[model samples]
Target chain A: MDMKEFKLNYYEKLYLARHFEDELMKLFADNKVVGWIHSNKGHEVIGVSLALAMKSHDYIVPHHRDRPAYLAKGLSAKSLLAEIMGKTTGCCGGIGGELHIMDVETRIYGPTGVLGSNLPIALGIAYANKLAGNDHVVVCNFGEGGSNRGSFHEVLNMAALWSLPIVFVCENNKFVEFTPMQKHMNIEDVARRASGYDIEGIIADAFNPMETYETFKYAIEKARRGDGPTLVEAKTYRLDGHYEGDPMKYRDEEEKKYWLERDPIIGFKASLLNESIANESELESLEASVHQVLKEAVEFALKSEPLKVSDTFKNVYA
Target chain B: MTKINFRWAITHALDEELARDDKVFLVGQDVGESGGVFGLTRGLYEKYGGWRVKDTPISEEGITGLAVGAGMIGHRPVVEIMYMDFISLAIEQLANQAAKTFYVSGGKIKVPMVVRTLAGGGFKAGIHHSQSLESWFTHIPGLKVVYPSTPYDVKGLLKSSIRDDNPVVFIEHKGLFSLKGEVPDEEYTIPLGKADIKREGSDVTIISYGKSVHQSLEAAEALAEEGICAEVIDLRTLVPLDKETILKSVEKTNRAMVVYEATKESGFGAEVSSIISEELIYDLDAPVRRIAGAFTPIPLGDAEDAHFPTVEEIIKVAKEMCY
Candidate 1:
């Protein structure tokens, strides 16, 4: 497809993901939601870019923070909202809550709540898919803090030894809960560590949709062809605190301004508008339509009920 | 049936499964060249080659978690934790992830993985090496824990565990690795949640599993000689435990004595005793007796034999129950 089509798909997905998390924050504030949430609002560009780089049949295993990835994978807004409301209409049928929105059929294996826990699982999926004679690639979306965890090292080494078809997309928003990246690790870019595994290492402008998408295209294609996994460090910012309510005092004032000025949504809008792909009016109308969709999803969740206690033990044996 | 050792029974099960299915494979430390610490996986690497029977670095958390995910996607991964005590490092993956994946999937997924490890207070494996934490695993709801005392149970249960669509913690007692018993020369599969009656009697029920089952049988023989008539029930599977056999024995004999090698504070024996107290309370003539290891860290391996419950202790408890 051409750049115009790519721009349309990526922008719509990025905007929807951003708007989705913003609504979730408000719902959480009103206590209209039952479970905890991790929003990836400003990290949308990276998630959208990575999604386009992957084939429809290729795997995308995301975490709680990658709301954009969830949307990119076409997990329904109604289902996500139902999950937050603990309704049976949710993915995993509300048993897994906000953190674990898995659809094994879609191959979006997880959004595991536990930190740095799903890397090996992703590797296993990639290994299985590769062994079955199909060239399916596995892309895992995690954070910078997860890169420092030993699971990252163990999985990377194991994946390298097996030459598995897995791509690790580290959307490094630069925080592990309350901890800063600088306090713990010496390295600036998480992707740079991939050299030790003898695989391709890259850094991308996570705010630039086209650049991020183009960078991942090569890696995803290579992995799908059984050329081994790539480490794509999408340097971005959360723009919000760890969860819905935390004071980001650790953030530098100028650094915050720098990222906000280069906010992924505004960056893409300006890029498209300057190129005359879509006017400001068109973008405004798109935003309005997305808001309506999200509103309907909120209504669906608000009108839902907590599943019965017997439902907890219903599917234990199957 | 022919004479075989515990380790050979393990190999036979692996051999049968490998020959039957291509998806089944083994992964663990020392499983390839050294053939496992107890030689349980001997000849598997040579027979299947490196890709199938692979040895891995000491990444217990990663290995077990990988097996969990692999099992989810139609691969039967049999991961071995070199020492049962080392399993503490991988508890999150084993207890939480593997056990919860199926239930969390709402039955859309299943983690068909088996974690084989040697546990118990023998072989001088040191404090960090030698320990019995079977109760901790049996306490979990979704997972099944299996402990086989004889070669027959090992071959049957190991084959069954590999084929079962659930996570099975197949624990082998270190003390019984070399113990000889009759194993069927042909293929056999022992179903989970079934108990075996090692000896029959009418006066009392002596209940146990793993190494302690042998001790219970020995005590039953001594009781038989004394004309006390103690029935011995070997609880092969700890979870989904065969309460039917134990309850039936209790209902007939009207008395029960539980035994194990784990600590007395809270061991597998505690669960069996509690079941007797809860389910067969009215049927019993006396409060059930539980014989287990002392509530202490297993001492040095030399003194470890004393730390575990013995036939002397079982016989003494059987005498008390007989009266």
Candidate 2:
């Protein structure tokens, strides 16, 4: 795609994610959603770029903050919204809710609530691909706080040791739940931990979609070439609270303002306009299109059937 | 039929399954080139080569999660956690990931994986190596817990577990590894959730599994000498427990005694006792008696003898229930 078209496409994804979260918050307030929705409002570019760069066969094991990744990976907003609303039409038939929504058809492995548990599970998918002689790679995403988990360390060493085709993407939004990055770990960069396993580590400014996309492309291609795993730390911020209802007492106003100024969507929008990649009319049209899509998604989710009691007991065994 | 040791029975099952299905692979610490710490996976590594019979680093959680992940995408992975005690390190993956994936995914993914681990007190392997922690897995739904006793049951059950489309926790008794029993020359597989009547009697039913099954059989023999007819039931599979066989035996015998190698509190035997009393309480002539290990952590080597339930203890429980 040309630079103009690429920027427009990136802008569309960013707006869709921002609007998705914005509408989701309203739904939560209206009590239409079940469980917590870890909003990926600011870090949209990190997951969206990775999804954009990923191939059809490549698997993505995304975390709670990666709802945008699912959208970018081609999961319909209708299915995703229905999943969050506990409707039968959801991705996992409403069994996984928002926290654990997964669609095997999209090659999307859902996350476990147990912090970094998906790292090793994603490694398994990569391992299976390698054994099958498939060049497909798995992009396993986690937060900086999740990097402190033993699953992170153990999975990295095993992936490197076996030379599995996998990429570990760390979205360093600083806070791990209520704890800050510095308080949780002494290291500033999660990618630096990759050196312990003798793997390549790269850092990218996730606020810039071009940089995030290029970084993921390099790491993903390197993994597909069977050179082993790479840790790509996407530097970003949690524009919203950790969860929907998290109190903002832990974060200072100045720090919040600093991250807010660099919010990826705003930065990308300014760049698109300043560079003349897209006109004001074009950007407004894209925003209107995203709003229309989300409106339909909400209607579809609201119209879908609610989950029955038998649904809970249906899949206990194969 | 040919008589073989329990360890070789397991090896034969793995070998046959690895040869029978291309999707079947073994990955665990020292399982490949090293032939496993117990030499159970010895010849298979040389036979199937490194890819199928792969060895792993000493990361129980990693390998267990690997098996679960691999199984989720159609690979039949049999991961061994050298000792059941080390399973504590991987319980999060086993219980949370492996056990729940099929259900959470609404049956779209089938985790056809087997976690084979050695558990029992006779190995003198200290608290970390010697533990009958089957009840911990039995408590988790979506996981099939199998504790086989005889060589025949091990070979058949291991083969069946590999073929099953769910996560199976196959716990082998370390004490029974050297014990020999007749296994058929022809290919055979014993289905899960089926209890075998090792010895039949009308007076009392002795419910047991794993190493305790052997003790229960011995106890039944002694009970026969003492004029107390005790029926010995070997619960080959613990999760999809053979409730029919247990209930039928207790109903016919009218008295039940549960014997197990695990601790007395909340052991798998307790589940069996509850099932018997819940379903066939009116048929039972006497209250169910439980003979199990001491509540303490398994002691070192020979000291495990005192902690583990002995044949005399089973006999005592059986006599108490029967008389």
Candidate 3:
């Protein structure tokens, strides 16, 4: 928990995530990606920082918006981009696009389209880990909308009662689509809801990469040591609309400006500068390098062979 | 071979799976101390304890989703839906998420789980509680649907379903829970796609399954008194249907009568009739006859008896074909 290297790695990963989201924005505008796309643009620190803290054996069930967390955990950009193209070469083939990309090998499962469904599933995965003597944790990610779904209560009740080893990362981005959290239900912090389940709850600044990492580390360490589930609410913002094409006319101009000013990527960069841990030249060089990875990923995705229509019969069994 | 009720056969399957592998576990509304609604999972909680035999919340969607997710990690989860009618609430999770997980992952993950529930209208539980919707599940390509009628089929097929790497919908009929039949004590499995022949004859082929299999047997017995021979074929698993056996029987008899307890309109019997007409069209002597429940909500209490096809109705249809 006290390791400084882990904090540095988290910051670096979040930087990569921010760049990935930025590239995806251009791709969406160009129509290079098909179907709908959700972004982790404003919440990069929470997504990448948490993934950086998780052990290889630990599993992650990320909602649709956590692209950085998924790619950071293990999924290759080529496969992820191929999926965006709806090509057979994509991970999970063309059937699962942006919202459903998953790498089962690394346990970064479910870029689940359905909001709250992953809560129980993540709890179940953690239950499996506990039974198998894995001592590994399951990191669950969901946005503010998920807090209202029935799955949230069912999973929380069971997870608390069973003492399952899970860390619920509720990224309170303040809005469910266009509806503000205040409109959905009356609660100051989503993390406080966990007190009803008799479990520990903590709130952290989603834009602060260091705080997000520390909060995730506490939950994961508690799970690894068999202290039961923890609810960690990362207060973040959604820089984009619910979907790529949404007009988002419901929001006031000022509300949009508030989130844009507090963009986690910029906040983290400022922190690195204030700490003198990273130089401006070093940051530019790292951005340049990550851009190359994305460029090669795009090329790899384009050059990749299309899945044949006849190949559909393969991979059902075994 | 052990003479076991359908309930005990299912219990035996669960007991066997739990004893053999540590990863296999069960959960449902009343599976634990309640011993399951129909007692299929009787004494499981006391035997395996809470970790394996879990009692879950009333949210069927959550139950199924968790089972699917847990299965991905490496657990063989057998979740029970209290009644087949309630499956409608969880179809989104079961059909979209669990059924398509493997194909969506391009073979990287597997949803190795079983959803067991009781279907059919014999209980006369009315429109809300009574339904035989296994055909709804069979429409999907990724899922494997099993409708087991006999104790032997229940024990064998459920064991195979739990061990299989894909999701399986194991539909049991509530009326057949107490029905006893000979089941082998030895561990065995009936392959997914194979069918069973309950009776042999040359006059006509009676294709039925689950609760309808018994109704077919009753109709066959009535036909025997009138000196007509009918071949009774019980399709234990509907998804990986034993079409080969049904077709072979239809070829010999040159006539087929498909029976089911579901609605007569576009019921599974209609699917069997289509399969027969498609495969053995030239060999047919008479048009394939289907006897099924009346196209109405299953009536409350015993009043549904008229809507539910009786042995007389089956015999009436069979005699019409015989002449």
Candidate 4:
């Protein structure tokens, strides 16, 4: 895709995610939505860009804050909203709420709430792919704090040793559910720890869709070619609190302002205009279309019926 | 028919499964070149290449999660945790991820994997190596727990566990690995959740599994010499418990005695006693008795015998229940 087209598509994804979460926050406040939601507001580029680079058959194991990644991997916004609404039309038939959204058809394994739990699962998927003689790559996304989990180290070592087709993306959004990055780890970059497993590690600017796309594209391609796993640490910030209604007192206003000013959506818009990649009208049209899509998704979710009590015991076994 | 030890029975089961289905593979520490620490997976590594029989690093959590993941996506991965005590490291993967995947995903996915781990305390491998943790897995709703006593049961049940569509925790008693029994050369499979009556009598019913089954049988024989007929029922699977067999035996014998290697408090034996009491309370001639290990960590080799339930203890318990 050309730069203009890529920029336009990236802007649409960012707008859609931003708008979807904004609608969800409203639904949560009015008691329409039941469970807690981890907004994917600031880290839209990280999930969308990486997801855009993946094939339909390739697996994407997402963290809680990865609705954008699911959308990028072809999950219908209506289905995502319905899932959060605990409706029967949801991807998992309302069995898995927001934290456990899964679409097997799209090969999206999970959006696990457990901090680094998906890493090893992703390794297994990649291992299965290799054993089946398939070149499908598995992408596992987690937060910076999740990198400290034993699963991270153990899975990386296995991936490196076995040369499994997988990519480990750490969305280092600075805070780990209220704890600052400094307090959590001594290192400045989680990517640096990847070398301990004898794998290549790269740092990318998550706020920049172009940079994230290019970095993850390279890693994904390398994995598909049987070169093993890569740990890509995307530097981003969580614009909101850890979850809806989280006090978020640990971060200062100045820090929040610093990141808000460099909002990925705004930054990408300026880049598109300044670089003469897209005109103002083109960007505006894309933003309008995204808003319309989100509006329809909300409507679809509202019309969907909640799961019945009779079906509660349906999914407990095969 | 052929006579084989419990360890070789397990090996033969794995070999048959791996040869029968290309998707079935083994992954665990020391399972490849070393053929497992117990030699249970001996020779299968050479028969099927490294791909089918893999030697993983000592990462129980990682290996368990990997097995769950692979199981979900069309591969049947049989992971060995070496010792059941170390299952603590992989509980999150087993209890949370693997167990919940099928249920949480609304049945869109199924984790068809078997976690084969060595349990029991005769080796005196200390607290870290020796434990009877079958109760822990049985408590989890989405897991299938299997504990086999003899070579015939191990071969048949292991094969059935591999082919099962749900996540199964297959526990092998380390002490019983060398115990031999007659196994049919023809293919056979013992379905999970079925109880086997090794010996049937009419006085007191002794319900047990794993190594405790052998102990119960010995106790039953001793009781028979004294004209206190004892029926021994081996509950091969704990999760899908054979409640019918247990209740029937309790009703017929008018007495029930629970035996197990795990601690007395909240052991699997407690579940059996509870089920019998709850359903067949009026049929019992006396309150159910239990013969179980002491409520303490398994000590070193010298003190291990004192910790586990002895055959003599089972006999004593059966006599009390019968009288």
List, residue by residue over A189-299, the lDDT tens digit for candidate 2. 888998999999999998888989999999999998888899999998887788999996888889989888888788889988899888899899889989999999999
iRMSD, per candidate, in listed order: 1.6, 1.0, 2.0, 0.9
Q: Tell me the lDDT of model 4 at A249.
A: 83
Give a tens-digit lDDT track for model 4, residues A1-318.
975677777778877888888989988998888688887888899988987899888999889989988888789899999998899899988879999998888888955768899988998999899999998999999999999999999999999999999999999999999889899799999999988989999999998888899999999999999988999999999999999999988999999999999998888778888988888898778888888888898888888999888888776667
Order of candidate numbers by DockQ, starting with the best: 4, 2, 1, 3
Clashes of 1: 0
Pairs with steric clashes in candidate 4? none
Q: What DockQ, on C-alphas, does every prediction get? A: 0.61, 0.76, 0.59, 0.81
lDDT of 3 by residue, B31-61 (tens): 9988877777778899999878988879788
State residue B25's C-alpha deviation in candidate 2, in Å. Answer: 1.1
lDDT of 4 at A308: 86
**Reference-based lDDT, residue A152, model 2:** 87
Q: Write the per-residue lDDT of candidate 4 for residues B7-78, one digit (tens) a residue.
A: 999999999999999999999999998998989888988999898899999999999999988998989999
TM-score of chain B of each: 0.98, 0.98, 0.97, 0.99
- Best-fitting candidate, scored by DockQ: 4
**Cα lDDT of model 2 by residue, B1-323, tens digit:** 99999999999999999999998999898998989888999988889988888888888898888888888889999999989999998899889988888777766877899999988877687888888899999999999999999999999999999999999999998889899989999999999999999999999988889888888888788889999998899989988988999888888889998888889899887888888888888888889888898999888878879988888877777777766
lDDT of 2: 0.89
